[model samples]
Structures are given as C-alpha cells and as structure tokens.
Target: MNTNTNTNAIAAARQAHSTRCRQRVLTALEQAAHSGDEITVSAIARRARVDRSFLYRHRDLHAAVLVKAAEPATASTGGPSASRPSLIADLANAHDRITRLSHENTQLRQRLSEHLGEQAWRESGLCPPDDIDRLQRRVTELEQHTAEQRRQLAERDDELDATRATNRELMTRLNRPHPDGA
Candidate 1:
C-alpha cells in the first residue's frame, strides 16, 4: 500500500479502538455499579482494573455512569418489576393482534394460490387471480422493506465507526502539541 493509504488505515483502526474502549468502559462501570459496587473513584478503578489515580482523573464520568446504571432496564418480558403486570398485559394484547393478522393473511393466501384456470377451482369461489397477484406483490413489498431496514442498520454501524474515528482524533489532539508550538 502507498504511505498515505497505510496512514489512513492506521488512523481508522485507532479511532475504532478508541470508541470500542469507551463503550466497554461504560458497560463495565454500569455492570459494576448495578451489582452493588460503589460508583466511587476507587470502586470504579478497581472494577475497571485501572489505577485509583486514573479513576479519579475521570471522575466527571462517574455520575453519568452511575445514573445510567441505576436506571431500570428498558426492555422487560414480565421480569420482576413493579410495573411488570402492565407490561405483560400489553404483550398479551399485541400477541392477540398478531395472531388475528396472521390468520387473515393465511386465509387470503389460500384463496389466492388456488389453480387459476381450473373450472373446479372457479366453482370453489376462491379469490380472483388478480387479488392473489396483488397479495403476492404486497408480500414482495414487505420483503423489500425488510431489506431496506437491514441496509439502514448497516449504515448506522458505519456512522458509529466514523464517530469513533472523530473521537479518537480529538483525544489524540488533546494529548499532543501542535506541529507549530502554540
């Protein structure tokens, strides 16, 4: 690779590492605090496997870390929380709605896929071939929508990489002097 290409690749790798490190640190701090470890400087340092001084140096992040850790988990499928019954109720209602839709779709598709040119099929009073074709088209549209969602998810991942790169650059600049002495 050319020097410029190599340099750019190294910079991108460094930024990715920096972002991963930050996220891992936050996750570790959350788990530690949630599991009843003190969110104090020494406690975090111990949990992070870093020195006490290093933990103190990043004390500003402590409160945010603790707050996020202390908040209840956002997703619950009837786990032991005060509001779990309500969540369960809501889930049950959603399940019923899904079941109804699924049954309706199945019936419609059954009527659709019948033999189009058969006289017996005609007498069976199935949905017209055009309606079946429309339903098939709708299914294709739904599949395309799912593909678009996956593409969007991949794009978001790329953005995360870029954000991580920018953060690494900022941190590096913070720790280094300008080429021209300031």
Candidate 2:
C-alpha cells in the first residue's frame, strides 16, 4: 500500500509540472503574438523555456504553434502589420529595382571598358592611319566610271532611234510605186 501511495504522488507531481509547462507555453505564445515577434516552433519553445520535444509531445501545443506561425503578425506596437500580399509586393519591387540597377551597372561597365580599350590602343602607338584621302579617291574613281557608263547608254539609245528611223524610211520607199513599171 505504501508503494502504491508513492506512485500516485509521483503521478500527481508530473501532472502539476505538465500543467505549469502548458500554461507557460500559452503565455509565451500570447506575448510573442502581441509583440509582433515570429511564432516559430523553436522560437516558442525558447520563449516558453520548454524543450522542443515537449511541444512536439503535446500535439495540441504543436498545432497551436503551427496555426499561429501561419498567421501574419499583427502590429500591436502601432507599427505596420506584415500581411502576405504587402510582403510579396515589397519583394517584387525590390527585385525590379535590383534588375534595373544591374542593367545600368552592365551598361556603365561596358562604356568604361570601351574607353579603357581605346585609351590603351592610343597609348600603344599601333593606331591605324586615317583613310579619308584614300576613300575620297575611290569615290571619285567610281563617279567617273558611273558617268562613262551613263554616256555609253545614251549613245546606244540615240543609235537605236536612228536605226529605227532608217528602217521606216526604207519601208515607205518600197511601198511607193516605181517610176517605170517592171
């Protein structure tokens, strides 16, 4: 009978300890939520001064933590509430800003690289000579060739016209009656 009484006392003490731990966990959860702090399982466990395994062992407590964690933190401190949509919009804006900055950075880098390359080339004394005079001479030669081709085409046109006129005259004379009939 004495051994059974001792067992009951042990069970009672364990039940009391469990009740205290559960209360502590609930209080910690409320505090964390009110303060707009993160409600992760690890954070709750630490805040409650309870082992992670303890929360896991109590399925109700674990589910409560999960539910609270899924909820967006309410700003009881007069700050902005971090809603899911607002956070996502903020992230998208940040990503767009980063993309724009990256593109600008690439353009600036390319310009700098081009400027440096030109400077280096000039310093190396290997710059190619200007070909303005050569280009001008070539242009003049092509213009003269083009003029000659046009002149030849005009001459051919005049010759063709004259040949057509002569053929018409010959045909007119042949069609006319001869002075003496054959």
Candidate 3:
C-alpha cells in the first residue's frame, strides 16, 4: 500500500513538472510572437529555460513552435524577412555566381582579343602565307634523313675499327722471326 502511494505521488510530481515545462514553452512562444523575434525551437527552448529535447518530446509544444515559426512577423517589428543564416547563404551563392561569370567573361575577352590580334597581324601583311602541312612534312623528312645519316656513320665507324684490327695483325706477322729460323 505504501509503495502504491509513493508511485502515485511520483506520477503526480512528474505530471506537474511536465505541465510547467509546457506552460513555459507556450509563454516563451507568445513573447517571441509579440516581440517579432524568430520562433525557432532552439530560441524558444532557450527563452523558456528548457532543453530543446523537451519541446520535441512534447508533440503539442513542437507543433505550436512550428506553427508560430511559420507565421510571418508583424509589420511593427521589422517586416517579414529571411533568417540571418538564409540571407548569408543567398549572399554567398550570389558571390559564387559573380565570380564564375567574371572568370567566364575574362576568358571570352582573352579569346576575342587573341582573335582580333591575329586578324590585325594578318591584315598588316607582315606574316607570310604559311603552308603548315608542307612545313610539317619537311620537318618529318629532315628527322628521317638525320636518323639515316647517324646509322650510316655508325656503320662506317664499325668498318674502320675492323680495318684497324686487321692492319695490326698484319704488322705483328711481318715483324715476327721466320718460322724456319732464317
């Protein structure tokens, strides 16, 4: 019987505490609405001196906060405007777009300038007409010819070395004493 009574008392205390928290949340929301302050869960929780989870834990309080937050601020307290964080995000996005466009504009100007410069240079008649394909073919031919000359030079060097070796052998044989002891 004592345990049952104690349980009942504990339940009542918990209910009272929950009721107080709910009241505090409602009062805080009302104050915020009147003051035209942003009605976010965190702000309400701070103003109510309750944990954010407390608001979430109570569905009624949570819904109330959502409803209040969605309502536009009255004209008396600085007409409806975007939240600070959202405004900053929008500003950042605009800056990024500006930077991207600036870079694109710079690239376009450079290409245009280069094209105009090339046109002017051509019109000045200072640059001779260039046959790029013919020049490329000539360069390839020269490279092939140089490779062939190098190969030929290497073959001549090998032949010269062989000839020198034969000459040395002949000299050694002529200078040697006759095999018959003459």
> For this target, which candidate reaches the highest lDDT against the unseen true structure?
2
User: For residues 1-182, what per-residue lDDT tens digits would candidate 2 score against the true structure?
Assistant: 99999999999999999999999999999998888787888999999999999999999999999888778888867776785556779999999999999999999999999999988887898966568589889999999999999999999999999999999999999999999985
Poorly placed runs, candidate 3 (over 4 Å): 1-84, 171-177
Order the candidate numbers by lDDT, best to worst. 2, 3, 1
**Highest TM-score scorer:** 2
Task: Compose the digit string of candidate 1's lDDT tens values, residues 1-182.
Answer: 69999999999998897566556567677776445444555566566665665444555566665565454444335455323345568899999999999999999887766644466766778837747888989999999999999999999999999999999999998989888888
1-182 per-residue lDDT for model 3 (tens digits): 99999999999999999899889999999999887787899999999999999998888899999988877655464656665466668999999999999999999999999999989988998865767679889999999999999999999999999999999999999999998998
Error of model 1, residue 175, in angstroms: 99
In candidate 1, stretches whose alpha carbon ends up further than 4 angstroms from where it belongs are 49-63, 66-182
Error of 2 at 33 (Å): 0.4
Pairs of colliding residues, candidate 1: none
Give the poorly placed runs of model 2, Cα more than 4 Å off. Answer: 77-79, 84-107, 119-126, 129-182
Q: Score every model by TM-score.
A: 0.29, 0.59, 0.48
RMSD of 1: 43.7
TM-score of 2: 0.59
